[model samples]
Target: MQFLQFFLCITVLLLYCNVSRSAFLCELNQANPFKVALTSTVDIAGKGNFTTIQSAVDSIPSGNTKWIRIQIFAGVYREKVTITYDKTCIFLDGAGSRETFIEWDGHERTNTSATFTSYAENLVVKGIGFKNTYNLGPKQNDLVPALAAEILGDKAAFYNCSFFGVQDTLWDVGGRHYFYQCYIQGGADFIFGKGQSFYEQSVLYYSLETYGQGTYIGYITAQGRDSADDPSGFVFKDCVILGKGKAYLGRAWKAFSRVIIANSKLSDIVVPVGWDAWQFVGHEDQLTYAEEDNSGPGADTSKRVPWQKKLSEGVKGNGHVKFKCPTFLKFKVKAMAVTLSDDEVSDNESDKTGLGFVKSIFVPETHSPNFVPSSKPPVSEIVKQAEVTPPRKIRVDL
Candidate 1:
């Protein structure tokens, strides 16, 4: 009888352990079971690899060459997230901008203002919403500038994301960055910094009641290129600038500030005098504020400030200006090539849908050796594969 009881107890313990392990694997492999074989991937849900985005980020080994993908499930993560310089090749994949949001309240003066700050190289952030919830005012005087995201990383790309704040919504602080199909909301000098950045097919929203009140006066950019030799500038191409108040295209944050808004749609909210001098005097000639092929009610250049350049005839807008680094151009070429090729395919696949465009940014149909697809796999095959494969090296902070 004693021997029989011992055997039964051992069997029950083994069964319990197996079930627990299977459950853990199922949750970790919720999106893609074979993702473990492709690249280092981590899933962050309420009950997954790690509860918070920061915890998942912290677990990543520094100076990593392989891309580490952090797939965040739908939730409001109220935390100040930062990707340090040592953590390179990190891909942040969120469920969707509307579903996954990372928010915090910080300001420029306090040095803790940015809700999302990245200082890593080759970082990709997609389908997420980054917000700075610092309130700005009371209809009369008080105003504060907070940053939603500060991208100080080289070759960083943000796709299908949303940045929300009152002032300084996006600080393109340094390096070469690209914002594609992203929504940025702000008021005073919202898109600022000394970065060679491009905003393509993105929405720049100027909120009326968000910043300092009374009259609706807002400025979109304040590019801080200190010298003419600096290869830093902002290019807004095929973007939509629409919002509730009057705004200037940009102001001279530095003497040789450079900005170009080309082939974009501007709403009537854009002021006729579309550029400002700010406090800089006698720097008009040195500044490079230009507009080309822009349309809509606000694109009338006749009333624009005389200092702002109207690109004439064959001269392309800022064509000679090159990015400070080489990797940025390479990344841009790769992205454009992928997009163009995908457009040629005629199959009505799920990845070709409107929502699929957003998904494609982070989860490519086929991945490079360094990347992993974040799509669901066949259940039967995945289970078999999981059974044979060794357990993934993931730290679960339960």
Candidate 2:
């Protein structure tokens, strides 16, 4: 049966190899960067390796390092799924968000209530929809924590997927992650946590469905970093936030919490006071909730919180400082006189994450010489320079 399926796969690929694409074969010990050499299929029908997603996941050995592809066919699977910690290097492929999904009705226990939870490293999930239907059912108005997905692993990414719930929709617990062109929806604190993540071109739908617990207003994020050295932040670059009721962009969930909404579109659903200090009233100067180059009715910051002042604080660098826009958790050099280097932030041990690479980075040209792209100082070098010229450290709150 395995040989017959392999023959059929080869026949199908040979018939559909494209001009700008190349066909990949499943081979062991091969050197292809896209190393999807083994496949485990999951389908509601009895036409694949496993009939259920959990059984397919159970087949993978612990500490597995190869790129194992689990292709899920078109269906709405009504089961709670979890990729365990030992099952690393998985590529979950689905038909489409509208055509394929996994959901459950787990209502209590925020730590274990997710319909889909991934705790593995080097994982890539695409085209799947995770929904916790507890609040969407008969208890639609319950202000409870129903998480669609909780990501707590390193070097994981999601693309073209959807996460749905009422509150705490995505628990980006910790790690470095990237979400590209995905859709996330919830009522309060929908997208929260301390993960160092880059959300690029994603869509946020804030449904003010069950918001009446704390302050009567909804909060889009509850991100909280531990300290100045904590490498955890949520950077939403070039995204869209749309909804009905008035909501603050985020509130300080911790003392040194950090969130940046940059180059995004905000509808009138956003409140005039953009952010809330929550319990961090005395430590407002410690947290960082910044907005850059946003537009639309809600983007009007005339009535925003005084702490979040306009960038009219003025520029202090060499005219303009530029960093590469987000692209799949990657960074590039801009070739400017004093631009950051194309440093690889993947699998690094430093507490400073990719966004941290830009924190307090710009040193006035008067303090230093003209730095070409290759000669740009590393993030650590700036700290050493601070020891020399303490006044030259221009702190950026990203």
Candidate 3:
């Protein structure tokens, strides 16, 4: 017993020492770094490395650039940009969410000509606004997959970023991605793709379009791909789902399209059924849309779709099932904390700092402020749609 106690004490001491050293090193790095404004005015007012985003991207090492930081000033960059696969560990630090805007407009349903071969991967577009400006002019919906940025590679992470679009806003067309503190907006099937994505502490906005007279159109956020042991699924934890026009949290576009919304807030705007199989493909058997201790007006089980499972009491809800099984199984709210930080840290801080760590530490009574029940109208109510009048051809600000 004494030996065990001694060993444990030594381990703790070593860990503490390692963590302290790491914190010191991180502080040292943060002490001085290049600010885009002070460093250069490639586009703004300073003398930075390059004027355009593409130029900066071209100048970087294509094969493997470690910790390549690009600070984007507060400006609306109106262009379609694609970060190639060779660009790795690219960090885009924005001035602020509203200040920085990367705007474009593309939709899969509307645009049939825009072509892209998906080979880009291993990138991080953080701390900026990705806006879709395609509908602002005479041109409308001509951009297919009009992604402000399309992540088609593996191991991508988008942090503190904003994705704005109508349809197919974010193509999770990659592998093992993590989105933290990001704001994603779309209209119809906006955030749909086959990539395995985990969105934590993010804000999701769905737009409501008119459907005939008195009817309104809604949006679907995700669509998983064809994979038996996908190992990748949509895990939305501590997120806010809000919008107008009877939006359902998801629609299974493909069989085995799985989503797990746990300890998150769902706005009343979400349809009572929570999810729908796109046009009833008959693969509802493989679809897994589930929730645990979720709140809101949209969370009422009485009106859920017949195919959707409410996870009633029994072996399923008994906290014995493993989340890794890929089946429509339930697990105890396995509380894990993934600490999100700006940069990498040493082993000590990696052990101590909760930055970018995924720990399922969910307490039903207490969750993040943005976390809410799907049945209840979210605190941040959806932008109310005003009654539309016949277009009278306005010249300015139509």
Against the true structure, whose lDDT is highest?
2
TM-score of each: 0.70, 0.73, 0.65
**Model 3 lDDT per residue over 1-398, tens place:** 00001111111122112132110000012223421112222344445666566666666665643345577787776555556666554555566556766664444443321112124443444566676655323454443445544666654556566766656667776455667666776666777776666776666776633322125556556676554434345777666676556677888767757666765667677877778788646767566666655667766657766665433333124532222211100112333222212222111223332222222211122111111112323322321211121111101010
Candidate 1: stretches off by over 4 Å = 1-45, 108-110, 136-142, 210-214, 315-398
Rate residue 239 of model 1 by lDDT: 73
Candidate 1 lDDT over residue span 43-92, tens digit each = 44446677788877887777665556788888889899988987776778
lDDT ranking from best candidate downward: 2, 1, 3
- Ten-residue region with minimum lDDT total, candidate 2: 1-10
The segments of candidate 3 whose C-alpha lies over 4 angstroms from its true place after superposition are 1-46, 106-121, 136-145, 209-214, 309-398
Once fitted onto the true fold, the runs of candidate 2 whose alpha carbons sit more than 4 angstroms away are 1-34, 137-141, 210-215, 309-398
Q: How many pairs collide in each candidate, listed in order? A: 2, 0, 42
For TM-score, candidate 1 versus 2, the one ahead is 2
What is the lDDT of every predicted structure here?
0.62, 0.64, 0.49
Model 2: lDDT to the true structure: 0.64
Error of 2 at 186 (Å): 0.4
